[model samples]
Target: MPVADDIKSSWADEVELEGGALPPSTEVRENGFKIVTDYKYNEDEKKLKIVRTYKIEKRTVSKSIALRKTWKKFGESATDKPGPNPATTIASEDVYMQYVTSKEEDNKPEDESSIDKLKSLGDKSVVRCRTCGQEHWTTKCPWKDTVLIGGKLPDDKKGPAVTTGFTNAETGKPGGSKYVPPNMRDGAAKRTDSTNMARRDDTTAIRVSNLSESTTENDLEDLVKPFGPIQKLYLAKDKTTGACKGFAYIHFKFRNDAAKAIQALNGHGYDHLILNVDWSKPPTHSNQ
Candidate 1:
């Protein structure tokens, strides 16, 4: 009995010296604690406590990537829900703004010149430079330190009409302009000089070919009236007989109308003859 009592006393002393025992690589601190190994245990009547601490590092995210993530989350939520959600709405707005900014960046010219910017404007777009109040590059601005000298080419001026007070010997008509020298004119121009000078072509006009000689201007008008308003109708006729020459030009008030008339009337049969309709070629000279 005495030996057993001595052994128990020695064991208690050993436990006190070792701080009531601890897990491997763990130490007993004088303060609250270092780490919590288990959820069990407590002091007094409370549940057992395990204290722990960690040195957590903060993470940084890029704006683009963060926006993308938020947008993705919002999309998922919207897909699951039937109606609108504030979170999804905000996300969509941000995403759309980012997309537009990206597109602007892509479309931006490398030089960023006002001239380049003005040239890039589409039919629907109009850009006015803030510096010059003109639709051109800012760097080329007159108000800037650098002056743009003659950025535009000189105007093409027709050297004053060569007025030669002469008359055609056979025609007995006063010719204010000298005839283009035979050697100087291109061969094509020389061959069709008279016809080219006498005839004119309108842009908003459709030429009808393969027409019956009996086809009159009135008849052509009736055929094209359904498409648009008629500006003028000229049915070629024989100067002597005053009979149609089997071809005519029909001008429309609008180019769109002319195009529509061509589409509807081309290859259409009129007066028992199939008509060929197409855009009239513009004349070379203003006189024509």
Candidate 2:
């Protein structure tokens, strides 16, 4: 008969001292290992006792034990080998990171920039101004000068909203639903492109806070330009005062480059404030 691994069964066996015949019907079977037993009976007190014993052989190793064995082997190999080269160690890490990034890109969507289209469509397409019936945005409209408000241009009205999505017969997307008068659209695409580009590069964006009010866009650009190629730099400003809000964002072309910037630039001293740099969180859509 086939036996289960490490099966141990126990039963009582009676052997009478004064019996006419000890039980001959008792039987044992299946014999790779012998059944061992011990008996204890009073030599002359007429008392009896029975005992049973079995041997156990465990075949499974514990996880901790296996881990210790692996560590021992690794340590032995390290003790026998020479130390690794420092330059090779750094280069290997860089190569490994590139491999990992490429694998991740294969599994995910291609990274895209918000300003890619804007870069493609520089000043080739000119926008017209709506306020003065000329080609310009409301802020740059010449008619703002013509509008008389107490014999002066009104402080409240800047100009007509920059027109976008409007198609023209010449050098415009065909089959556009609506046509914006050349007088109505000025620098609309450029403005929209900048806004979208500001929010698009979450993977490469670094949030910098505690900026001095005097810090300018050019200053922020120069500060981080040493780290990597910058895709965009936007310094938050108060609309009313047109001054820096003590915070800014910088987007680098690569995540690795952004990480390097964060490591090297965080807590670094600027003009008047120590910069706090970190990865920018993705914008919340609901708030916008």
Query: Under the 3 Å rule for N, CA and C atoms, how many clashes does model 1 have?
Result: 7
Residue ranges of candidate 1 with Cα displaced over 4 Å: 1-201, 284-288
**Which window of 10 residues has the lowest lDDT sum in candidate 2?**
146-155
- Model 1, 31-104: lDDT tens digits are 54333333442455334445444333345789987676555435456464322343545433343333335766
Clashing pairs in 1: 41-48, 41-49, 42-47, 42-48, 114-136, 114-137, 115-137
Worst 10 residues of 1 by lDDT: 157-166
lDDT of 2 by residue, 150-236 (tens): 212233332334322332423332233354543343423345455656556677999999999988898888889999899878899
* Steric clash pairs (candidate 2): 128-135, 128-136, 129-134, 129-135, 129-136, 129-183, 130-183
TM-scores of the models, in the given order?
Answer: 0.31, 0.31
Candidate 2's TM-score reads 0.31
lDDT of each: 0.58, 0.59
Please give the lDDT score at residue 27 for candidate 1: 32
| Candidate 2 Cα errors over 4 Å, as ranges | 1-200, 285-288
